[model samples]
Target: MDLLEEYRRATMFFESGDPGGAARLLEPIVAAEPENASVRQLLARAYFASAQLVRAEEQLRALLEIDPSDHYAHHVLGRTLERQGRPEEALGSLRIAAAMRPDNDDYRAALRRVEARTGGRPR
Candidate 1:
């Protein structure tokens, strides 16, 4: 199958609550295309679903290094940071994600949660 098809299959697995399966499918794709931000992002999502926070963070960080303006990477990193009890950092990343895609409710919600936890507005 093509890259997009493989990506779609991985996404379907993730949405179906089979993140381990998704991760298994995405591993080779990521290894084969290390520079593909989209594949890395999908692998990060799978890792997050499996509660592999460290791996997820690593993937997101790598994606950010490749493209700092990636909204999804910012969003995932924010979520991972929040889970790791770094509300301040989470807020910063979520705010960047919200700014990158103001219409995305997930980023906005994460930003709001971090704000509430920190008792401060976006910085």
Candidate 2:
């Protein structure tokens, strides 16, 4: 299949609650287009959804290395870290995401949750 077709199928799988399938379809695309931030983001999301937190963290960190200002990457990485029982580490990433996109309620909520867990005031 073509890249677009594969991407579409992977998205469909992800949206249909089959994240493992999505990850399978996206892995090759990610390998083939290592610099494609969008693809990497989707693959990272797929990994996260599939409970592959380690891979998700790796991909998100790589994406952040490529684009430090990516609010979504920070937010997702925060959530991933939280899921891994690392709320303290999650706080910094969530805070950065919330600060970057102050209007985003989801980001704010995530930041607040992490802050509360770490005994920090939610600003």
Candidate 3:
């Protein structure tokens, strides 16, 4: 199998709003190249868009392990936690993302919203 071709196809599916399809296509690619951050990140995004929050969180965490400086991974992890109804748990990641990229309105907004919802404390 041409992993690059498969990755491109998965990206197309993701961009076309077929996240579940993307996730399905990406699963094998991820398995074949477990250390590929780009493939894993796209898989994580597909999982998140498909509402497979747990899987998304897992992939995002792995990405973090690979590169702690990944602000986008932190942001996505925060969003995944928030979607899972764990606003308090989301705070740390959101804060990190916002701090790392203070210019990102979305990251800052997410951090602020979660802080407000959780009263700036974990539940």
lDDT of each: 0.89, 0.93, 0.96
Q: Tell me which of candidates 2 and 3 scores higher on lDDT.
A: 3
Model 3 regions lying over 4 Å from their true place: none
Give the alpha carbon lDDT tens digit for every residue of 1-123 in model 2: 598899999999999999899999999998888899988999999999989999999999999999999999999999999999899899889999999999999999988888888897432
Model 2 segments more than 4 A misplaced: 121-123
Q: Model 2: number of clashes? A: 0
TM-score of 2: 0.94
For model 3 the local lDDT of residue 14 reads 100
Off by over 4 Å in 1: 1-9, 121-123
lDDT of 1: 0.89
Tens digit of lDDT per residue, candidate 3, span 1-123? 999999999999999999999999999999999999999999999999999999999999999999999999999999999999999999999999999999999999999999999999965
| Weakest ten-residue segment in model 2 by summed lDDT | 114-123
Tens digit of lDDT per residue, candidate 1, span 8-112?
899999999999899988988998899998889989989988988888999999999999988889999999988888787788789889999999988898888
Model 1: lowest-lDDT 10 consecutive positions = 114-123
RMSD of each: 2.6, 2.3, 0.8
